[model samples]
Target: MKTDQEIMQNIRTAIDDCTKGIDDAPSLQYQIARKAKGEEPVVKKISTTIVLVAALLAITAVAFAATNGIGITAFLSRIIGGWNVNENAIVAPVVKENTSKWLNLTGTEAYWAEDGLSVVLKVDSADDEHVVCYSNEDGLLDETGERGEQIAINGEMAPLDQWRGEKELIIAEFSPLGEGWNWYKRTDDGLFVIVTFSTPDAEALQKGTDVAFQIQDTNIQTGETEECSVTLALPAMTMQEGHK
Candidate 1:
């Protein structure tokens, strides 16, 4: 696996070799690259078309590393320890959303790598009353601060009446259940989440795969649980159409 520095250096070396053939003065950026050249090689005159093609590689190596403000990058940083749009990574803009009761789940981006598949989600509702929780015991506590219930929420073990700050919460951990889903960010309209799954099917997902997970909401008092199975059909992404 090549680091971003390695990638940039390789591209610059290729660009330097390309400039030697051009009759025209190389751009200032390319000029700087030439000074770092190692042993002198045979200089053969080449067409400007080849130089432009080499420049494209330089753009892809450097520009794609920055995601600007993307939720997918946030999740990736946790796994990789930093921001990196590596050669093996695929970041594609996608819209695959579903709604269950008042809870609306939207898939904004798709990230595929060797480990598994993950989708960046935006979870919202018609109102602000519910908090995210898992049904399992090791997860969030029940509304009454006990361990038995179908509906879930971040009860904070204080019971229903005392619950506060529901708006600013974003789920950090994914479910341990089959095909787990994930974290979010506070948004004016709603929250952004990244649903991740652990599977050995990276090869299959990269070719396009269908994924589904449970997303539910609970009415704290009524205990009425509206659970929906959200399905995401991430499109097939190739090397040429990736990292943007």
Candidate 2:
């Protein structure tokens, strides 16, 4: 293949010689001879009329779609990530909220304590579920305290390492079963933070927990000091009987 320099030289000669009269016809023919010699001539100019017509058509199409609120931008994003977001997929908004409610100490209680990490919550019903959500630099680190990739939430594929270099957060929704805790982390900030809730059946609960985190709006500021309550539903079997 000819390098860029050789191609430009040929084009320059062809254009410069295009103005030559019949007296220079032989030279003009010689300039473009390289094109037949396996050197692809460069195209510097396209028909402006055709380009303008196409541009106008595109503008009209986009304007029509905008007026009707029909677009493929979101659908395209999901398909690229191996996600099939149903046109009717349910979307639950993750709102930053604050609640004064507390778990009743006397209610069924499940304690999560593994060596140094411990968390406690009272179990009453699915309504008693709570998810502890906070973003920290250490969040990027695995339970072993070593840096690790974030897990999936709702069967979403693994995130490209390139996109996970920043701060991350997960919402650990603890149910009554209380033994093995499963959690989902939202990689992207948005109104509908997709998740796969645990089911009562063993098979359903055992479905490896995690999903892809889609970025919604990173503009959702953190550390605002405005605490919020998040509700997560879970199956009763997820909680196990434990000491009070």
Candidate 3:
């Protein structure tokens, strides 16, 4: 059996490997703008997005280590301490709800700290089997089969490209944060995804900002693609205290 330290070391290594070439990660602004303008964007695998969160988590760990000097174990505890076995347990105090005919966004929990913002989304769909895909200017790329999707923020079509010049707001990371089976499992009833957005300006994000979260899915038999989105009105920022 692996010791706790050993496991953490392994995680660190995985994070390093996953984030090694983040410069190559798809450009968020360019792709989204291309699609908005009716152009086809480059193809990127879904794993790229998933690995992104891993990289962000790794970055979060590093930031915590720099401040607390405790270590990764303690950092992990501090970040996920609110997680409950039931999954539905209310973790963050600021929660919201949005639903559509095809997609049911059951719950959204968000928190903001000195470093950045963390969001957890609980989604349910009516389709028996849905293919989650990423949209580029060219068209939809199946996450399970083709691999990549355009990134969005606060329902606005703006891409990271536009903000590259702005030094104040930096999108350190944005991707689905999942673990074990939750990472790969796709079900009709309940699907949970964790998304983390890091920036130097946590204050701006925490002060009741409006941001859009978007996801695209395709029906297998019908060959119809649907775009679903939720606009979240985030409340004021709060420091991450002890586990909720």
lDDT to native, each model? 0.50, 0.31, 0.44
Winner on lDDT between 1 and 2 is 1
Write the candidate numbers in order of decreasing lDDT: 1, 3, 2
How accurate locally is residue 222 in candidate 3, as Cα lDDT from 0 to 100? 48
- Candidate number achieving the greatest lDDT relative to the actual structure: 1
Question: Whole-model lDDT for model 2 versus the true structure?
Answer: 0.31
lDDT of 1 by residue, 1-244 (tens): 9999999999999998887767575555664456557434446668997676556644543455454443433343233212234544545534444546556565666665433455666555545765543233422455563543232232233442333344422122334236554554433333456666756255666587677666655554355656556677766754322222
Task: Indicate whether candidate 1 or candidate 2 has the larger TM-score.
Answer: 1
lDDT of 3: 0.44
Report the C-alpha displacement of residue 211, candidate 3, in angstroms: 2.4
Worst 10 residues of 3 by lDDT: 177-186
TM of each candidate vs. truth:
0.46, 0.22, 0.37
Find the candidate with the highest TM-score and give its number. 1
Q: What lDDT tens digits, residue by residue, belong to model 3 across residues 46-95?
A: 78756766676667667756875543432343344232122222244333
What is the alpha-carbon RMSD of candidate 2 to the true structure? Answer: 21.9
lDDT of 2 by residue, 1-244 (tens): 9999999999989987886676645565664776677575755667997687556645655554466453433222222222222223212222222142322111111111111111112211112232223222212433343444543433354542433334333322333232332222233431111122223234432332211111111111132122224433222213222211
